[model samples]
Target: MAIISKLTIISILVISFALAFLAFYLISPLSKEQRKEQIGEIISQLINFVLFLWLAKILLNLQLFVQDPLAVLAYPSNSEAFYLATLFTGVLLFYKRRQKKITGVLLAHSFLQVFLAASFFYEFIQFVWRDNPFSFHYLIVFGVLLALFHLLQGRAKPQNQISIVLAVGAAGFFAINFMLPYLTLFGYIMEPWFLALLLAACFGLLIKDPQDEPHSETH
Candidate 1:
C-alpha cells in the first residue's frame, strides 16, 4: 500500500508537469519552432537537475547507500538534499549561461511560468485527491503567485516579472514556515538558510544590467 501510494503521487506529479507544459505552449509568445527548441533545452536542464537531486539524496545518506544502494535510492530526499541539489544545478545553469549556451532571460521567464503552474496543479490535485495531509496555505500561495504573474504580464519586463515572482514566492514561503513551524515544503522542511539562499540568488539576477537581455527575449 505504501508503494502504491508513492507511485500514485509520482504519477500525479507527472500529470501536473504535463499540465504546466501545456500552459506554457498556450501562453508563450515564441514561434512554434522556437518553443520546440526551448522546450528541448528546458527538458535537458530538468533532467540534469533531477539527476543532481538524486545524487544529492544518495550523498546525504551515504551510510544507508553503502549498506543498501537500492534502499537509499528509494528513500525520499530531505530538505538539505533538495537545497544542495538546487545549489549545484544553479551553478551549472550559471556556467552554461556564461558560456552563451542558454539565454538567462528566456530561461528564467519560461521556467517561472511553468513552475508557478506546476506548483498550483500539484498542490490542488494533492489536496483534492490524496488521503495524506495537505497544506491549504501552500495551495493558496501558489494560486496567488500564479494569479499575480498573470496579472503582471505586459505591465512588467520579463526579467523584472521573474524577479518579482521569485521575491513574492520567497516571502510567501518564509511567512508560511515561520507562522507554522510544523509545516513542510512538499515533505521537507525548508529552512531559513535555504530561503535566504533563494533570495540571494534572486537578487543577484535582479542586479544584472537590463541591457544584457537577449534580443529574442520579450514579453
Candidate 2:
C-alpha cells in the first residue's frame, strides 16, 4: 500500500509538471529572453517555497526533530506544513508585488492559465483512468467554461480578461466540489452550499466594473 501510494504521488507530480509546462508554452507570448527570465523567476520561487515547506515541517515537528533528527527527515509533511508554506508564499508574493519586483496582474494571469490547464488534465485523468463519473462531468463543465473564457479574452481589456478567467475557474471549482463533495486538504468535509455561495459572490464581484458604479446625484 505504501509503495502504491508513493507511485501515485510520483505519477501525479509528473502529470502536474507536464501540464504546467504545457500551459506556460500555450499562454506565454513573450520573447525568448523574456520567457527565459520568467522561467528562472518561477524556478527561484519554487525553490524558496520548497525550503519554506521544509522549514515549516521542521518547526511543526520540533519535538520529533529534537528526539531523532534523522527520523524527522523520514517523516512526511503534515497539513500544518502545507498551510504554513502557503501563508508564507502568499506573503512573499504580496511583498514582491508591492516592491514592483513582479507585476501582480500578469502573475495572476499566468497562474490562472496554468491552473486551468492543470485542473483540466487532473479531471481528465480521473475520469479516464479512475472511471469517475463526477470527474467526467466536471471535465465537461470546466472545459467548456475555460474555452469560453479564452474565446472572449481578446474582446476585453487584459485585466478584465484575467478577472473573468479567475472568476470562471473559481466557479468551476465550486461546482465540481459541490457535485462530488471532496474533502479539504486537512481532511475535513466542507459545506458545498457554502462554497457555492462564496464562489458566486466572488464571481459577481469580479464581473462588476468600476465604471459601472452609480454616480452621486447632485441637488
Off by over 4 Å in 2: 70-72, 132-134, 183-219
TM-score of each: 0.88, 0.71
Ten contiguous residues with the weakest lDDT in model 2: 210-219
Mind giving the per-residue lDDT tens digits that candidate 1 earns over 73-138?
Answer: 988777778888888888998898788787778777778788789878888887887744456778
Q: How far is 2's C-alpha from truth in model 2 (Å)?
A: 1.4
lDDT by residue (32-80, candidate 2, tens digit) is 5555555566666767877888888899889999999877766766656
TM-score of 2: 0.71
How far off is residue 21 in model 1, in Å? 0.5
Query: What alpha-carbon RMSD in Å does predicted model 1 have with respect to the real structure?
Result: 2.4
